[model samples]
Target: MSQMTSQTHAIAPEDADRAVIYGFVGRLLQAPPSAGDMDVLRALTADETEMGLALKSLSEAAQSANVNSLKDEYNALFIGLGRGELVPYGSFYLTGFLNEKPLAELRADMGVLGIARADTVKEPEDHIAALLQCMEGLITGAFGEPATLPIQEKFFTCHIASWAPHFFKDLTAQNTSAFYAAVGALGGVLVALETEAFGMAG
Candidate 1:
């Protein structure tokens, strides 16, 4: 079982909010993003429950992508010059620069949530994977406690809901994207689903 799934608690329906947070984290960690999981991606667009399931499905599917393809995607999305068609860094999204205040803000939030950046990770804390990991920690009690709905809503609004979907949309449409295109589609759909679900819950 995945780390998040292994750590999940059976909270009451009133605390079901954690499931959404965990699901998003699981997906981001499973793959940087990919284009071959369209069926699961489409399902995620329908509802939060479906989104969670699709995320799990994609995470599992990502493991099966050929090694060559994975390397290609990594090269296309992160190593390409002249901005690589999509910037997946939070600093870029927030300040039009890499490793800027947005990254600093995310680091502050990580401290608040009891998340620490892995020493092995060379990327900035605002990288999408790091953000998702922190979200998982917040929802799964890896932090002080599972975050309340109000806190979850605030986090989503302040961080994720602000720009991740746009990044995903660009990933989907980027000419160099293939495996990541599906990831972008999934990210776009999931963000909309999460925003709508939270809005309705309010």
Candidate 2:
């Protein structure tokens, strides 16, 4: 899988870092991590911040993670018999149902931003993974020119800040979570950081 980066976009280093974190978390949530993905995770290093601590934990988890076990864990956590332990979708979290007004609003914003879902993707665009990927694209010019910080802040406030923190919290608390617990912790910290950063930008 190709890594997402904003180096070609002339964005700030901080924006590039934001894109990488969004892409990393989004990729892990989008599906089970392959062995290659695990390798990338294992190579990650951290510092002293909360996000760094979470990254350190995730890197440790990746070092010991088995691909097949992760596959099973992914299935159990995201794609069980009918539903998983948690539904990782913005609309569901916001409206207590799937495919609601929030999704329509997102679609409208996506249209205005010239963003379109892949034809191969059957899931709604409100899925958390899709939203994070959209943010990464917005930051890295994957969709077009890199969006301004204000625009990024607007999209994040409308779609991500409203519900993802709660979802990540639930994910961390999930009974079936093991490796994903690390994912949840990292996601939570990332969301908090994003929320604070956007607030400062605003």
Instruction: Choose the strongest candidate by lDDT.
Output: 2
Residues 87-202, candidate 2: write the lDDT tens digits. Answer: 98899999999999999999999898988888778889988899999999999888778998888899999999999999999888887756899999999999999988877867
Best by TM-score: 2
- Going through the candidates in the order shown, the clash numbers are 4, 0
Tens-place lDDT digits, model 1, residues 69-163: 76666666766665554667777987899988777776776666556766666767776665656565666665556777677777777778788
> CA lDDT, every prediction?
0.62, 0.88
Candidate 2: segments with Cα more than 4 A from true spot: 1-8
TM-score of each: 0.72, 0.94
lDDT for 131 in candidate 2 is: 91
